[model samples]
Target chain A: MIHKSDDPVIRCDGVWKIFGARASEALDAVRSKGLSKEEIRDRYDCVVGVCDASFDVGRGEIFCIMGLSGSGKSTLIRHINRLIEPTAGSIYIEGQDVNALSARELRRTRAEKIGMVFQNMALMPHRTVLENVAFSQEVRGHDVRERTQTALRAIRAVELNGWEDKYPDELSGGMQQRVGLARAIAADPAILLMDEPFSALDPLIRRQLQDKFMSLSAEMKKTTLFITHDLDEAIRIGDRIAIMKDGVLVQIGTPEDIVTNPADDYVADFVAGISKLDLISAGKIMEPIDAYTRRDGPIDFDAWPEAHPNQSLDQLVDLSIATQHPIVVKLDGRPLGVVTKNALLRGIKGDTAPAASAA
Target chain B: MDEDTTFNILDPFSSIDLGIADSAGGIKQWAIANRDLIQPIKAVFNDIVTAIDGALNAVPPLVMLALITLIAWQAAGRRTAILVGLCLFALGLLDPNAWSLAMTTLAIVISAVTACFVIGLPLGILAAKSDGFERLLRPVLDLMQTIPAFVYLVPVVMLVGIGNVSGVIVTIVFALPPLIRLTSLGIRGVNPSVVEAARAFGASPRQILLKVELPLATPTILAGVNQTIMLSLSMVVIASMISVKGLGNEVLRAMGRLDAGKAIVGGLGIVILAVVLDRISQGMGQSGRERGQRHWWQSGPVGLAWRLTRARNETTPPVSAAPRTEVQSN
Candidate 1:
């Protein structure tokens, strides 16, 4: 699920997007000498969208960009597709400069390689579900039979097979979103740019679609740049998460990395509501079994609490409360380490383990 | 040029009978006095009406009926096509001049609205694209729509000298605002997220307009067309003051002779056309026209929509189609 290759599918470097008549000048001033966002806005009458944002999304990676409204997460995602051309800096998809592409080349790249899903799943009301799904193919002049078959497959993938002939207006909000998802994947593009794709849905439906998206991304292995204000969603789906503040990228790391070791107070406040249970694993906080037994006198062979090395802190807490016995951390049924009472308490409290192993 | 003859054709309300002063001129005075400003504008309408009238009348009545039926069928269902066919046929049989006159009126409406769309669509698109342009157009459109149709018609007839051309010019002035207003409003009202999706998916500007913006904006634009047609039809009897022949002219003649029966028949003709065109255009504007369970024999555009509606009327949302009950094993 996590792709850690040297060659990333999408790379953006030092991207700055300023919105004003003198945007370039404003950007230059910001880069040349550090200026506060308020100062730049007051002095130059320019609004910063994305300021010195840089990141790489490895192939098949779900790189979630998370920020609240006006945080420039949306603006940053638009940069990958060159929908908002950068004020400065470069974007390369498989090493071809996206900003440098001609209009035709950009369109071709968008059509063949990128698919985008938006928060507003306003599937074309005039078109049937099948037609909406097959739109990209139709635009590409693909033959009817072949494109429809592809669209049908995509529809079925989203569990919308029986409703292909229904217009978007007739479908429920969640169903309409599924149709949108089907439309995006119908083209089978190499990249997916999802801009808060599930943000509009009810919480129940949102979770359902999020689960569906995770599996679909795993199956399709499409490199996805997912944008969301919901950190829970980012933690659920992203292999790596980038947190933005104002118009700047403040931190980028795995969900575990962010939760356990937040980059700053802003990111800490953002991740504060996030539960530590899913993020902190036994492998991250366990002491070696030999050291544990030597310190604690002896291990009970029969009464010990056993957990897999990857078990979450919440699971360990449950096990700890269920019994007074120390927890045995086993990998493939062989005891690799121990989760003592002290270690269990620290894990639940989200305290960084001493000599923490990079996981 | 005589007041008695002019009085025979003027809207009854347009004439005021003030004793002693003899102020019978009423609203007509404004038009007469503004002749210097009104003539060139009237001349333009005269030319438009002439060109469209000649082009439409050149086709035989049967050919015209067939073409109208074809368009009706495409826009609506077979019911509208058949209805238009019957109306056209009945008009020809009831009065030999009826068909020709109807065609003339039809030509004028067609030219005015087509010209409206041609001119209005670009302006609408521009208005939608630029906020300043839209703000600027709002008041101008409001003025175009708010002016009394008869007041404008008086000026047009007085300046253009009352003919098919002058009648059409008046109709154009009456019917144009909605098309421009709705086209721009429709484009502006398009869902931004949908447009973003199209752009994100690599749709060129032209492709987005054709496939996304235009299709999504269609219902509003079609509504505009319907309003324009209805408004134009409403102008018929009023327009006949210019001596333009049509069902409107028949009504005017009946009014002059004080014949209610002739007026009724002529009014009925306009009503029939109005209903038929309104229903057909509204049907086209409605979505889900072709997205229902259908019989295998469903064929042409009208047939497709017809059968689909018929089939839909007989069915409910399929309960068995609920796939949500499936376990999320994936």
Candidate 2:
């Protein structure tokens, strides 16, 4: 579900962060001379942490920014809460410019509106699970009993009920991260900034937490800017993914948009290992019904198996195995297109040259 | 001054003097002039030391021993309590004057350490928060540490006058640097990500310091406290040369007379006291750090009471229930 609200929960406009004593000079060079990141680094002895990053996350949208290490994905997310101020441009949260807020107002916004989870979880080592989870609310001077109740509820939501009294060191890595999640949600903030929160876990535990976080976020309807270096994870959990490289956001689109049509060679290579079986929908691969009928004559729609236009390539494959005929892709009981075995194979192979039937 | 006549290039430099002694005299004069302001502060410190000394001496030696042992058992466990009990017993056996002298010395060290903490903690925190403060404080700490305690004794005695209070002032100067340095180190050593996490959650600077940073830095600060206590003990003895009372006086007298046996006894008393305090404080520092540890009540005096009540209630539930019902009816 893509959420498109007029007032985005987070909007980054031409945000730039160059790190070093000469950051402003480097940024100016980038703008005036159109210097590449390396050129700026070499000329000014500065590193561009984020270069002109701009994106809008709608209300309750799970917007994932994916990149390799040193790609500035983490730096970009931190700008939302004003943890790292933009060297240039502006960030707006719910139509209010974040940069324009006073120091007190910024802190209030962080406490009341945004909660973040760290890759290392960063749960206080001295505090018990319950205390760590209750900390955000406690810092806001919430009533102790009320915050405890809210924290316990969040702990339950994360399935860490019995381990509330345990210290962070006593917890396994996965459990500690669950405490991190619990800590973030306990505050009931509108936005959640998750910085590769599950990237450190083993694959099995990572998948489990991803599923848990996805459902919890959905139920709470939290607007999230999730950062990850893993493309598969972005595809699995993101409503829309922004692919970043060398401190620049290269592309922003839905998972299917990215996998089916990568913007450039870097993004294409990045998603090469990611399985597209589920991410590619029937709408992407189907030949239009008119095109199919023009080339192959009218189909006996009654004889073919019917599937929704939203059916994934994997589902279409399943249907193809169950029947000998092409599947008619339908929406609201009207045929939109046809997904023949040849077109399905080409889609699976990521070859989107119009199928012979489209000819 | 002519360098050529001395046949040395540096001869002219040697003729110049820094006049440090004059500077010291100037400070002494200034302090005397400001006696009105300084006197009340000295009197307050004097009263605090005397009060602590009196309170400690009020407790009979055996009772104090038992109390310390009880505390040790709670903080460090049974083994340390037994060891502490024996050490205190040995001090008594070693010197007839041990209890009274030790209490006086203990009172001085306690006051000095309390003063050090009061002064050092904020400075340490400031140093941790600001690099400029750290740079400013670091060199002063070095001078305080490297200056022979004897060298400062002259000025301290002159400025504060000769008394137990002056001795405490001296001990505080000697014992304070470590607490300040270690506290800064502890706070600075707190994981950066954890502090960031706190800030990300909208914690104010004060809240982050108190709730997140200090608690994480406790073990380290306790280690600093342990060092401060040891330093105070040693300085308390040195402070005795200026008419400060305590076991230090005994040691000083024994030394003047060259009485080997008496000197040994006094030294042994101080040694035993040092070992006992060190072990107890170290134990307190290490408490609650073990993996999967239970609540405080599960391990200390409170645990004993809880167990007794539970066992009695289990034996006669009706009797336990009767009291509650009576209270409710009342």
Q: Each candidate: what lDDT?
A: 0.81, 0.87
In candidate 1, the residue pairs with backbone N, CA or C atoms under 3 Å apart (3 or more residues apart, or in different chains) clash, namely: none
What is model 1's C-alpha RMSD?
A: 9.4
Which ten contiguous residues of candidate 2 chain A have the minimum total lDDT? Answer: A350-359
lDDT of 2 at B38: 74
Q: Write the per-residue lDDT of candidate 1 for residues A185-204, one digit (tens) a residue.
A: 99899889899999999999
TM-score of each: 0.76, 0.93
Tell me the number of clashing residue pairs for each predicted model: 0, 0
lDDT of 2: 0.87
Stretches of candidate 1 exceeding 4 Å from the true structure: A1-5, A288-311, A314-325, A328-338, A355-359, B1-103, B130-166, B234-243, B250-330
Q: Lowest summed lDDT over 10 consecutive residues: which window, candidate 2 chain B?
A: B321-330
What DockQ class does candidate 1 belong to? Answer: medium
